[model samples]
Target: MMRFILSLVLLPTLAAAQTPAADQARAAADALEAASNMLDDADGARDRVRALTETIQAFESGLGAMRTGLRQAAINEAQLTKKLQSREEEVAALLGALQSMGGGASPVALLHPDGPMGTARAGMLLAELTPALNARADALRTDLENVQTLRALQTDAAKRLQEGLTEVQAARIALNQAMANRTDLPKRFTADPVRTGILIASTETLDGFASGLSEIVTDEIEPAPVNLDGQIGELRLPVQGLILRRAGEADAAGVKRPGVIMATRPGAIVISPTAATIRYAGPLLDFGNVVILEPQADTLFVLAGLDVVYGEAGQVIAGGTPVGLMGGSLAEKGDELSPLREGTGTERSETLYIEVRQANRPQDPVAWFRTDEDG
Candidate 1:
């Protein structure tokens, strides 16, 4: 009877002792901690906007990791809880049986009806079962510990999520302020707005507008001819995004152009890919907000479809300087967390049109920017 009752406790197979969910949770906590530290360091950085950008990215990555960890932890906890609940009666019976037998510590508890020989045989049998029973006990203990740890981690992760969201928002606000106050870039020449308006009014096509760009130059200070011999195919993209349409590739409407179309997230930063002079910055025809850059004499890089255009025409900006921001409404807090629940990446809702012209002829943009790697 004692053996039969005790065997009931081992009826439920214990889960693996390793706590993968706990490991994931710990890693997520570390990522969040690193993001917090990065945010603190951003205050003293040389490029405040860039620093804040990095900080926001870090916070976003950490929050994503935490969400994944919390989800896995929850699943593991639920599985363990269900398993334990199913064997609840067996566990209770085992405890009662052990208590009645004085936990197998009393010699009288092991005595058999057939006297010494039977008693010895029963003891041997129990010895064989002891190791298996102990192993199950250890695994059960680990499962219970994991459940508790996962519960605590989930609770703590919620607090961290809120903190991360708040910090990222602050960084974004700081970035905006920094961009608005910036005014230290050099200028090759200032553009004549009146002449630019006249040129736009006369031109009907992008080619025609670009060809007459020199007509709007009020300050005709010629830029030094830039030698791009060694940097032909190694240039970074002006914005962080995925290449949606390659140069000369037809779109849904079967419209093909010599430039690539990039899909970017809302409010994503657009930077100058190289040290360049801004030839034009404003709306032109149906291109929406445009910023045409002259990285070299007779070479123009036209960036169109921007929500906001930064820097006036003729300003000499350094590589990686903020140029503009992509158009779209910022996601709310609930929307930011949508990726966690939906298992999808942040949506790229804005598109930027890029055209590279050399010696007045359009060139394939993929030859100028690396597109094999992830944005």
Candidate 2:
């Protein structure tokens, strides 16, 4: 009887243990489903955002044209006003002359003794003057009418421009809301190890494809230099960082290989390669924010994935000049850890990728560095 009682109690305990496990499994499945749904929603949201941005750009262009039209209209109106005022003055002067002549002053009294001929000449002058004054008045009236018409048209255009701007603002607000709503989706999905790993692998695959194309281009096509000059070499780290990758191998993306791969802690400064002109300063695919420097006329030094570019294109930079700040990659978040490095301690660290190209072909960057030392 005691054994039977013990079996009954143990049976209940075992059933309860299975219940929690089942609940946990169900919860995980639900979470995964939610993540999948979120991905679909994110894609839709991204499309909407892109559409809205384009619409906003179009509206901005229209607004610019409207502004130009408005300015020209204003100038036209000013000129018309001046012309109208001058015409009014001429009309007033002619009216005064007519009133004085009609007020019983003899035609001879109106003319100076030394002025031109006889009664026949004076009468002829009076006839011409009367018609000339009337024609002047008519022309002024017509000009005023045309000015009013143009002003009305300009006013309508201004109103339309205002409406367009309002629509653009509304669209922008909607886009912002959509983007905000979808922001959490990526985070939720990426938090899972499986999903994160998949994303990283996919990124790598895409990068490899891009690298392959770059290699083909680099091999087949040579970019002629606009100018050629002295060799620049021995580039020191703009800031300290670990070398993530070297220039020798083609990138996994199958593009032209970078000269060197350097990763830095977030906020690390990127210094100039040498005294050079900044050829390019903007975003590049996979590289994030990038700055390209022409150290010598023919040499192109690329700096990619920066937080900010400090100089403008065409601006000259001196050696060791801070060109940009290193930014954290969206793929990973930490104190800018370099995947190439094997340590976990808190030392100031960075990863730098360096490359040297001559006549659009890859050259040994090590040789350049060594040559600088020899010089």
**Local accuracy by lDDT, each model:** 0.76, 0.49
TM-score of each: 0.71, 0.33
Q: For model 1, how does the per-residue alpha-carbon lDDT over 1-375 read when each residue is reduced to its tens digit?
A: 556544544443333334776677678778878878888888898887677766766665566566667677778888989987887876675466455544546666567999999988988987787676556655566666666666776677767776776776677677778878777877788788888999999999888898899767866676676677789789988876779899889999999999999987676667788888999989999999999988888889999999877788889887777677788885665554343542444456789999999999999989998777444
Those runs of model 1 whose alpha carbons end farther than 4 Å from true positions after fitting are: 1-158, 202-208, 339-342, 372-375
Best by lDDT: 1
Query: On residues 1-375, what C-alpha lDDT tens digit does candidate 2 reach at each position?
Result: 434422332222322232222333234333334433433344356465445434443443344344445445555666777887776767567556545544756555766565667656877887888787657645555555546654664555545645554554565455456545432211101123343334434555323322232222111222233332343344554544555555666667976564766655444546775676655555555666667665654466666667666655455555665566555432132211222221342222444455555555556665555322110
Q: Please report how far candidate 2 places residue 369 from its true position, in Å.
A: 3.8
